[model samples]
Target: MKPKCGIVYNGHLQSDKFMVQLHWLSDTAKRHGFEPELIGNHRLIPAVIDGRCTLLGPYADYRPDFFFFWDKDIRLARHLEKMGFRLFNSASSIEICDDKSRTYEVLAEHGVTMPKTVTGPLLYEGFELEDVSSVPSIVAELGLPLVLKEAYGSFGEQVYLIASEEELIGRLKSLGAKPYVLQELVASSYGRDVRINVVGGEAAAAMLRRSETDFRANVTAGGRMFPYEPTDEEKAFAVRCAELVGADFAGVDLLFGPDGEPVLCEINSNAHFKNIFDCTGVDLAEAMFRYIRSVLYAADGSRKGDAPC
Candidate 1:
């Protein structure tokens, strides 16, 4: 009997992009001899963790052979993990990678090159911006054209490039005390960066992102994709980032620092692959499915209840 697999996503199936990826994942699972099912918000998703009315609905009250949280968010993954679901990428990894500042900290701790970062408290909590007296020193250290980002933001939504002190203060005031991070801007990567998809601690594919009009290079924000070949150093860094966060699959973004070294910018636990797939013929969904299946098979054989072959 084929193992039952659930592909979960937070968006509605009506979304074209989401549907495409879901189909790809389902197809890959079926090809690998698994009973793959696409479970979205409108339908019931088995093996889900209870108490969350997410796009995948509530848990089906029974354990599945395999549960894929897809891009449904880290919180759901954490809840499911607590409910005894075998997740491909654990909730801890998702949570760490989802926050840019945390991702930076993890990479830096592992000796990976990354921009200097300082996280601030939330604006709504009455955290005074005046408390950050070292702003000037930080600017002096990192120089002009620094990047400011919210703690939890995606798709280039909450990123800013402040070139002057006035601009920095104005932007901070506008943020209204929301938690944020300041980092040295990699001017060379102005609207450009490399995104590498790693599976099982190996670089599966890479693509260069370029946005001529915006400082953010997210494809969803009008960035163009170009095929990129990862250098030995880049490959090593990608692997390290994935392993550091304990991600079974990940998208590692790398930018060039002022010293011309490849530095980790961020890692995505549930990275979208259509852009990279369009640029490079790497089918990430298929690769991920194969890796997950291999792991499940190995784990099954290791269980005490399993018969010795």
Candidate 2:
């Protein structure tokens, strides 16, 4: 019998954007001899009864061999893991990558080349930020035109570039108690970056994102993507980043330095591969499915051989 895999997604976010991912992943899983099932978090409830946490829902009676976690629901992911479901990216990896401050801390410990960063202090909901002293110090350290990124955000939505002291202070005050990070802006990579998709410790596909109008190189931010050939060093950097984050598959964004060096930007465990496919004609879902099958069946004496390309 084929191994059953559950693809967990946020049912509340019923946008077509996320649904497309599910369709691709499920189709790929079927081609690779795995039974794929879709389970929306909205439809399921996680309950802790008698000191044991487990899921209760329409599909609660059925447990898959493993899970393909595609959502950022850390609590639900952890609950599933507690129930002995092996998540592809793992709950721990998702938690770290979902928070920029945590991701930076982990990568820094691994000696990754990243921009200088300072994590923002968390504050209570009703608390006022009266300590304006750190504002000047942060500006002085990172210089003007620095980037302010929320600890947990995607699609470059919560990132801001402050060009002046007034803008920086105003933005900080507006942010309230939200957790964020201040980082030195890479002038050399100002509207452009490369996103490399890595699976099972190897770089699968790469594309260069460019935004002429916006500083953010995210395709959602009106950036255009172009097929790009990555150098050996760039490929290695992306692969190492995936391994460091303990991700079975990941999209590693790299910023170019003044001397054309690859500088770590961010890692997305549940990276959307539509843009890369449109630009590079490579469907990373296939690579991801193959990687999953290889690892899942390697030690079970049930290897199904190579998946069709």
Candidate 3:
């Protein structure tokens, strides 16, 4: 019997990009002899009671052997896990990657090389910064023209470049008590960065994102993508970064250091692959499915061993 799997996506997000991802993943699953069902989070309700998960609605009794978690709905992912559905990236991995501050804490503990970052204090409602005096000292430590990023954001949407003490303070005040990160801006990597797709503990494809107009090199921010050949050291660094985060597949962004060495920028567990596909013509869904089969069905629809790579 062909193994059945579910490709979980954010159903409420009605976008072509989301549909494109589903199409690619479902097509790949079909080619690999697996029955792929598109599970939209909006239509499906995961009812939990006393540490038990029950499915309600169209998939009331249907259960898949595995799940390809392509959404950021962490609670739903966890609920599925509790119901014995194995998630590719896992719920814990998604949670960590969803928050930049937590991502930094995890990677730093593993000694991953990255820019110096300071996690900001969380601001609650009806509260303000009690000590505004430390703002200058933080600027002094990270220097001028630092990068400010919200802990929870995607597609470089909530990132800012603060050039002066006044600008930094102003932006900080505007941000209020939201969790953020202040980091040293790597001058060499301005308007440029490398994104490597790592799957099954190896680097598969890489693309260089460059933008002359915006400091952020995200393609969504009007950046251009060019095929990149990563050095062995650079590839190793990216692979290690993904492994540390326990991501079965990830898009790891690496920034160029002052001496041209690679430093970790960020890791995306549910990375959008449309740009990488257009640039490299490498179908990420195919690679992901291959990895899933090797790990989940190497022996009779159950993981063969502890070997994740």
Displacement of the residue 206 alpha carbon in candidate 2, Å: 0.3
Model 1 regions lying over 4 Å from their true place: 12-14, 41-58, 125-134, 258-260, 298-309
Off by over 4 Å in 2: 299-309
- For model 1, the local distance difference test gives 0.78
Candidate 1: pairs in clash: 41-55, 122-177, 123-177, 123-178
Clashes of each: 4, 0, 1
Candidate structures ordered by TM-score, highest first: 2, 3, 1
For model 3, how does the per-residue alpha-carbon lDDT over 73-182 read when each residue is reduced to its tens digit?
99988988878778988999999999999899998877688999999987797787666788888988899889999998899899999988788778888888788999
Model 1, range 6-72, lDDT digits (tens) per residue? 7777754467886777788888888987887666533444343366433344645434676776764
Write down the lDDT of every candidate, Cα atoms only: 0.78, 0.89, 0.89
Residue 218 lDDT in candidate 3: 97
**Who is ahead in TM-score, 1 or 2?**
2
Cα TM-score of candidate 3: 0.94
Instruction: Give the per-residue lDDT of model 2 (tens digit) for 119-202.
Output: 998888888877778888888889989999988899989999989888987888888989999999999999999999999999
lDDT of predicted model 2 = 0.89
Model 2 poorest 10 in a row by lDDT:
300-309
